[model samples]
Target: MIRTLDGKEEGFPSPLIQIRRQQSHLENWLENHKFPRIPCQSFVVISSPSTIIKAPKSLKSQILHSANIPYKLGVLEKKFKEQLLTKPTLKKLSKTLMEKHTEEDVDLFAKYNISKNDILTGVQCPGCGQFPAKRTQGFWRCSFCKHKAKDAHLRTLEEYKYLFGNKISNQQLRSFLHISSRTSATKFFSTLNYVHEGRTKDRVYFIP
Candidate 1:
């Protein structure tokens, strides 16, 4: 089951192709594990009822609208009853699949040679989705919509954490957030309740 957003149809993969690829991968994994090559099915459920799908007739059954899911699921349940594995067999397969897997972290910023200046920084407007919402009177106000938000900087900090790591100093926070005051940044970090190390200017906080 996959849920897709409205207005993002271009980003979505063809359900038929994704289903075939997934089924092929699953079959290969089952074969490698000396397990039965069980049949696999895929469903792409769009949340918007008005969203149109230009799928071929063969793929139409696999693409569902969110509103019709309950009835569709009820119909699919009757078909899959005979295909479910036994509880004991399922437990064995689960145990086998629980083996640890490790993947190396890839820094796309370094890999693509992206400079810090290339990234946009600032509290974004929740109202109009505009950047650099001005800090004024204990709130971040959007320049475009004049919308005010008290915790808009937190969202900006989240973006910073995703681009960089969770750890950030007061100076780094101010730089990334486009805040001028060091005292203001410290106060913001205090409100987050993150763990801190070192003292005074050397302090570094970790966002949880």
Candidate 2:
């Protein structure tokens, strides 16, 4: 589950539903693989510090345990200890899994048919997770939450590297970051330890 800093769930699959789905998937995978039908437990842990999930009583009772942040961490530790495998068993399982494991590269963006044009572009507010924070006097200020962050553009650039690719041009950065000033975009690029190819207008920056 993903939430904004303001504590709102951004996407689908509520905690209870997600946990049920996980349980179902686990059972299916084990059966398909011809593995022993070992007992399994599923948990929906909301790690966002600001987010407090208030599930229905009926749903809560059905779930194994739904905890938040640090509390969830403790539960995880306890669960792991309870299901702890011996060193020999661990080694055997690892060896068995490794023999059947095969690495596959997946392009999720393409597979999901997500368009670059549909993606929101701007400096996002770190405090409230709002976008299009105005660049003001060496700091990015959010009009919504009144949060100001210095070097906020750095986070936006890092996101760009993930959503797009490692290589980006000055114009592309400006468009994606909603930056109008070429000098400002260049200044932002200079702070990063990146490699560049081509000269002047044709130059492209690569995150090394």
Q: Give the count of colliding residue pairs in each prediction.
A: 0, 0
**RMSD (CA, Å), each prediction:** 5.8, 7.9
| Top candidate by lDDT | 1
lDDT: worst 10-residue window of model 2:
61-70
- Which candidate number has the best TM-score? 1
- List, residue by residue over 12-109, the lDDT tens digit for candidate 1: 45666777787788788878988876766677788877777776798788888998888897987888778557888888888887762454577869
Distance from true position, residue 103, model 2, in Å?
Answer: 8.7
lDDT of 1 at 189: 78
True-vs-predicted CA distance for residue 78, candidate 2, Å: 14
The parts of candidate 1 lying over 4 Å away from their true place are: 1-15, 26-39, 44-56, 64-68, 82-114
Per-residue CA lDDT of candidate 2, range 1-208, in tens?
A: 4456577657665776777787998778767865556567666654445555566786553433334445656766776665545677667666866887795655658988987777889998999999899887878899999999988888788888777877999999889878778998898788776899999889999965
lDDT of each: 0.81, 0.76
